[model samples]
Target chain A: MCELMAMSANVPTDICFSFSGLMQRGGNTGPHKDGWGITFYEGKGCRSFKDPLPSAHSPIAQLVTDYPIKSETVICHIRQANSGNVSLVNTHPFIRPMWGKNWTYAHNGQLADFQSRLATKYHLPIGETDSEHAFCWILDQLLQRFDGDEPNSEDLFHYVIGLCKQINELGVFNLLLTDGDFLLVYCTNNLHWLTRRAPFGKASLIDAEMVVNFDQETTENDIVTVVATQPLTDDETWHKMQKGEGLLFCKGQLIYQSS
Target chain B: MCELMAMSANVPTDICFSFSGLMQRGGNTGPHKDGWGITFYEGKGCRSFKDPLPSAHSPIAQLVTDYPIKSETVICHIRQANSGNVSLVNTHPFIRPMWGKNWTYAHNGQLADFQSRLATKYHLPIGETDSEHAFCWILDQLLQRFDGDEPNSEDLFHYVIGLCKQINELGVFNLLLTDGDFLLVYCTNNLHWLTRRAPFGKASLIDAEMVVNFDQETTENDIVTVVATQPLTDDETWHKMQKGEGLLFCKGQLIYQSS
Candidate 1:
């Protein structure tokens, strides 16, 4: 299994505060130590960084925690490597271009026998990971079903939810996917999310001795949503998603929820 | 116009020495100050770093110069931004996955009326740049031509060279493309290359005051080839490529030349 993190905000926001806590779990306080990867969507351009080293000891991970590259959408993953070997190619948060948008995907759970089972021809996985195979498979279905014509947001989200249900039958398939505009999350096991708006207060990390006051960091009108496999902060009220649930977030607001 | 740099080595080698010279041309010594991007291929995995700011002034660029990330194949570009706005999406070294490989491309010359003239359906450009449009068109043709079956290296190189000739007819189209195995270079006006093997000597940069003694940095078996729009080193004897010519290199050795 792996750990996934994603953020969607009304304005360009940094993930340093939350990432600081998550990095501690990658070999320091938790067992997800195989590798780590992140993607920050700056407009239509996505900046991705990946390392095959444990995030707790990686210098590049430290740089990520130090440098605040603000973005409207972000996705991150820390891998424990059940389906693939510990290598740069197998590092999480895989990306591909779809409908002229850079689509990024990260998975938190393991799938069963996804290599030979996957049937994707349009988009192929560069790395041999069950998560990547599943992502390409999903894209293959989406592209083939639409046939290059992107549907409206609501229709696309509903189609994606149906696809997630299909993938969920394979095994645990908690995933976060985004294409700069909409962030779609689907979970089979455990996933949590929280929205921060007006009347924000201080929050403390569960893994690290760090505290951040949202009042000083964000304005009253700013809307931010964070989704993770587990809650990063102890004080924040995270809504735990039920099994086989799907969500769609557009600009930090949840617009669609699976019934 | 943009500046392009690429390297193919028999062993994993750092491009810090060559990049130091290229970084100066981004703003200090030349006029390509719009943006910069680089892709370093470590095995089947590629690590890419990009910034919309000038490479000479970007802290990320400074980190690239300071951190010696070794790679066997590298592609880099510094942009002056003629076709698109100065943003992250318009940065050079556009990448996409093809034939289960991350195919990266960097262009050094300009194209006239490529946006509307390009006819591509499968792969689309996330950024609005003539170079990226051309790249997507090329990939579309390749994928359609092969039909999911990757051709042999020689056959693929011949097809790519033919495609390059077609693209060169439009305008100046000097480009470097790679799939971590083959480094294909096509030139219309300006492109130069040099190979350094055993019995290496000291070389000085043309754009910067940095000098490197290659004899102290390599083993006797190492063979490295450096390609750029302009010769990066003053002392090295680079072979200037002819107009409408294409070359293919594999593991730092030139394997094919245009007929």
Candidate 2:
């Protein structure tokens, strides 16, 4: 399995710190070095960068480490590549458009059965991987349901969740997605969350040599939450998810929950 | 003050169903008629359309209703301008590129005490709104901290959250951001989330004349999450966030917690 990290906060925030720490794990501390990708939302749009190289050594990851792009929502992934070739298309954190909005996604698990069946529907795969094919198939199914018109987010979410359940029955399906307004997450393998508000404290990452004293940088009213496949930091308490748990986050808080 | 809809799902899904219902609220069911914007994340990029008109009347929004582009993540906003003049730059969702990645953001609240004290160390305002200024400042701080290099996601997230907490103390700050990798959300006013997993059901919007039966389009393993400032559907249960809450979502679930 790969690794995933996401954060929603009560104020504008950046994922650089945690990303840097996580990058170390992409290859240095972990084996998810096949590829990596990340997406950040500014307002109603998104910026994404991906590399087939391990996040630990990629120049792009380094740049992300130094440049802190602050936003209310963020998604990132490091891949082990069980079902996809190591190419740009095989990278995690895929992007697409639906309902006139930009949508971004990343996944951290394998879907062995997603190959042949996925190709039967949706657009062709731009890369040789089940991930992209699955993504395309999902979109294709969505288009089919809506008759080529964008469905509402509510409808789309339910449909997609249902699809995810079906996929999970075949294999692991941990995923992260966003539409520049909300963050949707599902975990069939590994995931965790840690929210910080008043009384923030210092945190240290387990995989990297870094420490952040949130109390020094935050106020009593600030609330920040982080989600990841594995805890990025050792000092912070991360909440583990049940195998089939998922959640939707907006404005730094959990709005929808499911198990 | 405005109606917003977003979805993150484990599968690619179109948002026509929710948009149809939300469109009625754009002018018929809600007051956020100043403008509307939506973005979808496809593979490794994004597609977005914006109109400086009410979603109910905008041709672009109508086109969105008619065209289905499926994506894993989606963000849509119907605006009621509180800051910045009514222009494209003043739209609810703003997009930018940082550290070689696309960033998307949207806001729903007003900043009261930010006009005068905006002369800070980093990013400056590209638009007249405090939101833009804050975005610029956050970028500046990130650049400064990393000396123009992209920091890791964890570091960036922590740094941005620090700045967000500081500025939010000065005024209202309810915002969304993404880099196509993670969804980071901060709330100072209002936000909600709804997530569905296996055994999905039918749902209808509370503010519009639309309904969707997810059973027809969904699989059994899908995990989908939706977040919004207000509930878009009337028939489905929506989760509300308490004041001063923030979170980070990845992989279709909440990974971080903040209160």
Name the candidate that leads on DockQ.
1
Across B28-60, the per-residue lDDT of candidate 1 in tens digits comes to 898999999999998898988888889999888
lDDT of 2 by residue, A163-249 (tens): 778778767888788877778888897989988888888999888788999988877887788899888888878888888787877
Q: What RMSD does each model have against the real structure? A: 1.4, 23.3
What docking class should model 1 receive?
medium
After superposition, which runs of candidate 2 have C-alpha atoms over 4 Å from their true positions? A119-123, A147-156, B1-259
C-alpha-based local distance difference test score of model 1: 0.91
How big is the positional error of residue A60 in model 1, measured in Å on the Cα after superposition?
1.7
Worst 10 residues of 2 chain A by lDDT: A119-128
Model 2 chain B poorest ten-residue lDDT run: B118-127
Candidate 1 lDDT tens digits, A1-259: 8888999999999999999999988999989999999999989998888888899998788888998999999999999998878988899888899999999999887777686677787788888888899999999999889987988889999999898888887799998999998999998988999999999899999999999999999999999999999999999899999998999999999999985
Query: Which pairs of residues have clashing backbones in candidate 1?
Result: none
- Cα TM-score per model: 0.97, 0.51
Report how far off residue A192 is in candidate 2 (Å). 0.9
Q: Give candidate 2's TM-score.
A: 0.51
Measured with C-alpha atoms, the lDDT of residue B160 in candidate 2 is 68
Q: Write the per-residue lDDT of candidate 2 for residues B1-259, one digit (tens) a residue.
A: 6666677777888888878877777777778788788877765556566666788887667767876667777778788877766655466566654554556777676676776655544233445677766776666576678874667766666666777687787787776777666677777778888887779899887766567888877898877888888777777788797656776665467766577
